[model samples]
Target: MTWTDATLEDLVLLQRGFDITKAEQRDGQIPVISSSGVQSYHNVAKVKGPGVIVGRKGSVGTVYYCETDYWPHDTTLWSKDLKGNDAKFVAYFLRTLNLDRFDTGNSNPTLNRNHIHGQPIKKPDLPTQQRIASILSAYDDLIENNRRRITLLEQAARLLYREWFVHLRFPGHETAKIVDGLPEGWTHCSFAQMAQYLNGFAFKPRHLGENGLPIVKIPELKAGILEKTPRYEGSEVPDKYLLNDGDLIFSWSGTLAVDFWNSGAAYLNQHLFKVTPSVGFSAAFLLVAIRECMPVFMGKAVGATMKHIRRSALDEVMHLLPQGHILADFNHRASELYDQVQLLRAQNQKLTRARDLLLPRLMDGRIPV
Candidate 1:
């Protein structure tokens, strides 16, 4: 059977998302889908699910799929009408279009509905749509399951860190001595002392290419190295800037985050800190500690346009450190958890690459449903 040659309008109707200010938002479970996926949550949902969303403002053509009812924010374009197409299939099909090419802005890339709605797209019939979606969704289903497991594992690690470090509830707290609001054999350590923060060297546009070491920017940090991520084919960037797998990455500016790198070695771009624990510090400890410092870092971030925490913030935020014996004991427990997380993350990356490779082949009819 031949697939129909049609415009995007024939498959689905894309409309500008509704507007909702941050002040108007309240705590809830309904995801507020923006151009960058789910950034916030709302008490009420604006659209029914499952929905397909394409970035129209900031992220520029990035695609997102939501399973539950959600509010599509002003920065995105959501499918108002599926037009009898499988929603999941439409989501995967849009990914193969390379919609970012439709960007019409010079400085800030933007996606306009009018520009793409009349564009040509080859789509199959309803039955084929469902079959393709089913095959692809099987991959998604496994990815999502692993994602939940990762979340639970991370939560367990965080709780363990907090319980032993913050709340002072530890294995033998009953017998521990306390003095001047400090436990015996405990001393405060600043964030700066805990790890070495090596900011990545700034690389220019011409440095990027289709091959070589993948560059690690804030976007790549948030969403690993995606299909569209820029690569550096140039000469040796300084050794300090090359980050290996399982290294700690701290993005001090623009959506502050602390996470361990799961992808293989990549070039570290500016606005990212490649953190290495000090001689006495452990990677697992700093990973959790830095995450806990996010609120304080956010409070000190200074910028009207783009908020960012300075290096001074690291020195300002301090935490109590136990003696070597206690620290080593904690590291032993945390390392096991961190190792499990790394294993799962590495597995997810392989699964993602496999699915992404299969998607274009399946969508292009190279692999029939």
Candidate 2:
């Protein structure tokens, strides 16, 4: 391996992004890339394809790669020119520079692209740059494939659920007599009747600590616990609020959703509920049911800013339940597909960790390309 001394500007030139407001955006295919990544689409593009964007304002230091022309939002600084260097390699190398350090000493933290260019750093040859990018990209490519597979698996389960339950097209539906808009041996029950919806305990700022159970909130359900996640190290939390693997979690208040907790032990936070299946219900069935009715839940939610579902909404959303045998049969099929989704998610998690660890080492040439 060989390295040469060069300033940051010699390899890649960073420039402030264009400004666009949500109201000005129109329906189109171009992504409105912001500091936090793409949050909307626009009809026009400000930067050409194969661009690298770094967060300049909020979510400072985050990096994003785009393959197609994009609208870089004002809160970011994007690579205007790669100066013949491999784009992916530059993106990875930038991550090692700790650009977040430049974000301090301001009321609103921001990264200054102009101020960061003069520092001298090592530069790998073009061949080495391409090789390093190839190696790192391999890990990310597989993770992305697993994510696609996970999405497909979840979609399959959701569709099957809708067909069997929502549409009342279960296997034996042909022979079962329709009694009062439902098949025979079926009962309509409230959402609460089928599951134990225990809301998470509210943890104040004082309860936060360096270690313990990571607090699981509504949005936190998907990412699980991360290194920066706040944990509850204060007084002992009740046994009921502690999350276990495969526990069904529901965000009832804002952004209603259902997710299974696969990450390690976590303390459930307010606005979220640890849902447990009752007598004849299963996690698989409940997941599909809640998703199908999410629109209704969203409509029922009331608030000026942070819309939330009232507890009574659970009683309002009733589901039709079939005989024990039929319910069990559906659960068995759905769980199989649901299990695959969880497995893929777990694989992606591990791959992400491995890639992050290998990143700094590869950038510094510790590991031979």
Against the reference, the lDDT scores of all candidates come to 0.89, 0.87
lDDT of 1: 0.89
lDDT of 1 by residue, 313-348 (tens): 999998888878888888888888889989988888
Candidate 1 stretches greater than 4 Å from native = 25-29, 105-109, 202-210, 226-230, 233-236, 253-255, 298-316
Distance from true location, Cα of 9 in model 1, Å? 2.3
Candidate 1 least-lDDT 10 residues: 231-240
How does residue 228 of candidate 1 score in lDDT? 77
Each candidate's root-mean-square deviation in Å? 2.7, 2.3
Model 2 per-residue lDDT tens digits across residues 1-369: 677899999889999999999999999999999999999999999989898999999978888888899998999999999999999999889988888887753688788887788878889999999999999999989998998998888888888888888788998888999888779999888998988899899788888888777888765786777657888876667888999878999998767888899887889998998899997778988888888888988889999988889889989988877888988998888889888888887888889889999999988788988
Model 2, residue 282: what's the lDDT?
Answer: 80
Q: What is the lDDT of residue 369 in candidate 2?
A: 80
Where model 2 places Cα greater than 4 Å from the true spot, the runs are: 21-28, 42-44, 104-109
